[model samples]
Target chain A: MHELTTTRNNYQIDPVLTVWGWEIPVYLFLGGMVAGMMIISGYFLFKGRQKEPTCSCFYVPWVSLILLSLGMFSLFLDLSHKVYVWRLYTTFKIASPMSWGAWILILVYPVIIANIFIRLPKFVTDKFPGLEKYSKMLTDRPRLIQNIGVANMILGALLGMYTGVLLSSLGARPLWNTSILWLLFLVSGLSGAAAFVHMVAKNIYERELLAKADNGFLTFEIFVIGLMFIGLATSTEVHQEAAQMLLSGSFAPVFWVFVVGIGIIIPLIIQLFAVNHKIQHTPVAPIMVIAGGLILRFVIVNAGQVSHYLNAHF
Target chain B: MARFAMVIDTKKCVGCMDCVVACKTENNVPEGYNRDWITQEAFGNFPNIQLEIRSERCNHCENSPCVSSCPTGASHYHDIGGVVLVNHDECIGCKACVASCPYDARFIHPDGYADKCTFCIHRVEKGDKPACVSVCPTNCMYFGDLEDPNSDVSKLLKSRKWHTLHPEAGTNPHVFYLT
Candidate 1:
């Protein structure tokens, strides 16, 4: 009899690569959610709804600022050298998606900050009497507000797509190498944003409209996921094996249960019924969608790391 | 103008891991980490099986993904022989290069920089071989300018059939193995 042996150093590469921890997924989820918020706020502003009392444009921009900061913080924590993060801004590598993201984030601050002034709350103006002039300056110029809307939408889409492209560009990881991943992330972000606005907007019309939009985006999200799997299944054998991780492998349960069932399908069904007025609209559906979006990020990031180019051990 | 390349004669390798230890000692690599290692692969039925042992490290590929993916230009080609190296001060410890490498040749240094084999660029500038190639006792490794047809590494490739680690990756890896 003969024995065969293999060694995979733990401190080195192993059954799989696990360089990213919870931080990446948390950052990805928050970034995507913020992307969705920007698009929703931009769309509302373009329609000249900033004057309306229930318009979420006023709240979303400010909220997005805080949420994005949190997300960026998580991303910063993931860095091996946190102090040198400033180095990312020094030069732009056209081949690097992370560079695009850093620059996009820089643009996000000014645009979202400008949006907050379009409908600066009276309480804030009252506290800082000197700020009234800038608020009036922005609110008086509808055309300027509309331009910021276009900028937000454009930047929003870029931010959303950048999250997915970030993963897809690393062709070394078989699970993230699909062409459809960008669209999937963008749609998921849009869906999450729609659900959030539907939950928070006080106007009956706005809530109903956002509910309808949320349903549409969720349905599109399901389709995009199907296409992503189809693309993966048809790729090389290694890619197909990589897809197996999310399908029937160890990650299958979380993928099918938390992400697909509770996170997506149930919320999707609830929103569909609420949009149709077959059931009363509740916050449950939107919350589910948000949570599902987060879980999806976790599952994909973890599974992608486990899906090796040379071996499908996990 | 020297495109430095490495040629490993697998049949001559003993998988002693002298190369891994030498890299640690020479580079002062962090504890529980190394810049190179040995791999043993076997094929065929038990009695007729063929065992191939390889001492592997960073390929320092021509189309290096790690360099291209680095947002801060920390991972760049050195002047001596286009050897890939990470400037410790410039690296942000993002690990994007680590993920981009198909060979999994990198790890995060305890000091927060992406760490990997540099082909001993520091020593090479002084006209010394890489730690691994220099310490290899079995004489299974060779390093020289592949662009120079007269070089020993290039001559070995011309005389013997060789294969790279992941040609389909399109990395244009500079390392080759003689089976």
Candidate 2:
């Protein structure tokens, strides 16, 4: 009997793709974090919370803008042909997730910049009086700020969902083929953002309110994750094997210990109690939620790449 | 329009690396990499075992995921034979094509572009067979337009019981292997 011994076959990295690395996960985490910030801050802005002295809605657009650019930078670094990156925008293939992401990110900048000018610091406007027109235009029209808020909400959801869609579109990678993956990533972003708002907001009332919201998001995020795994587990044998990697394979350790256990459940329980006033709020739980979001991205991207069609017994 | 496809006879294949070597030399494929490879599989236990060998590369599927997933339109079907080809100048090397390929046939070249079997279109255009089909000592390979009823590949596929890899993928791959 001839042994095909493909274990020695090392072509194009490996039979399993390692084409993507830390760059992808880092970009996804930052992109999701910023996407969450946009929605949370936009909701408050739409509600006119910007009028409050210490409302997070006023400054987070600025932070979101910075984080999103950094996320794009990491994505840029992943491109093997950096100079041809402009070609992505030259044509819009409606079916391609990367095309959708490229256009969405471009649109995000203008919306975020306009949002920042809504409550421009007086000193900066005073220094650059010519730039004051933006503040005048939006501040003069209360409806436009609300419209900006609406735009942010829609775009934020698209950005968050697209992060997962990027991976999900590759049906060859069985682990990421579920439609619910987009919703899972979006809900995770929302939960992480709520935790951030709860931890950073200066107003005690707003902090308490955001902590409650974080718990709701966390609960929902857990449900969505369950739906994703169930969808995978019930899929074709190829997909079932892919799901097994995270469920019981080598990835089980990280997926269970870091992502489900410490990253989600423990922080979720702590935040629930803190919101209920049973425990004083410490930075620990919120920090864990944020770090958990990061770890989740790493696990998903890495495990998804390792999962392939060949492992299926036909 | 001519639709190019390749047909290989697995029963006669000796698990030789000739096709892999010829492709590297003809395409100037980077060192330590190849566009084609040999796969040998055996079924049942030692005494009653049966072996199957295949020389494989890009299937150039009619419904190719690489072309559809490409954000830049860099991976496209050549108008000549609907053969899949990548434009190095336009490819951003995002690896979306690499990841989406069900067969894992494409790879990123060291020069930072998606690379795969072209079925040796350069030679086919010059009225010569693919480097692999030409170099095979056993004459186990055939290449021609499958659309033409009179072509060698078309006739061979018609007469012999053949199978394509990953039929479940629904890619409608052009490459076929005769049992």
Alpha-carbon interface RMSD of model 1?
2.9
Candidate 2 CAPRI grade = medium
Global lDDT of each candidate: 0.88, 0.87
Model 1 ranges with Cα > 4 A deviation:
A1-12, A312-314
Model-by-model DockQ, in order: 0.58, 0.60
Question: Model 1: how far is A146 from its true place, Å?
Answer: 0.9
Best by DockQ: 2
lDDT of 1 by residue, B1-179 (tens): 89999999998999998888898999999887767877777767768988888888889999998998898999999887889999998999889999899888899888889999999888888899988999889899999998899999989999998999878888999989999
lDDT of residue B111 for candidate 1: 88
RMSD of each: 1.8, 1.7
Number of colliding residue pairs in model 2: 0
lDDT of 1 by residue, A1-314 (tens): 23334443636356568889999998888888889989989999999988797788989998789989999999999998988999999999999999889999999999999889886788998899888899889888999999988888988899999999999998888899898888988888888888888988888888998899988898889898888889999898779988888989899999999988988899999988888889999999999999999999999998888776676322
lDDT of 2: 0.87
Compose the digit string of candidate 2's lDDT tens values, residues A1-314: 34443422445457568889899999998888888989988888799877887878877888898889999999999999998999998999988898899999999999888788887877888899888887888878878888999999999999999999999999888888889888988988888888887888888987888888888888888899888889999988888998889889989999888888887899989988887889999889889988889999999998888888777853
TM-score of the second chain of model 1 compared to its true counterpart: 0.97
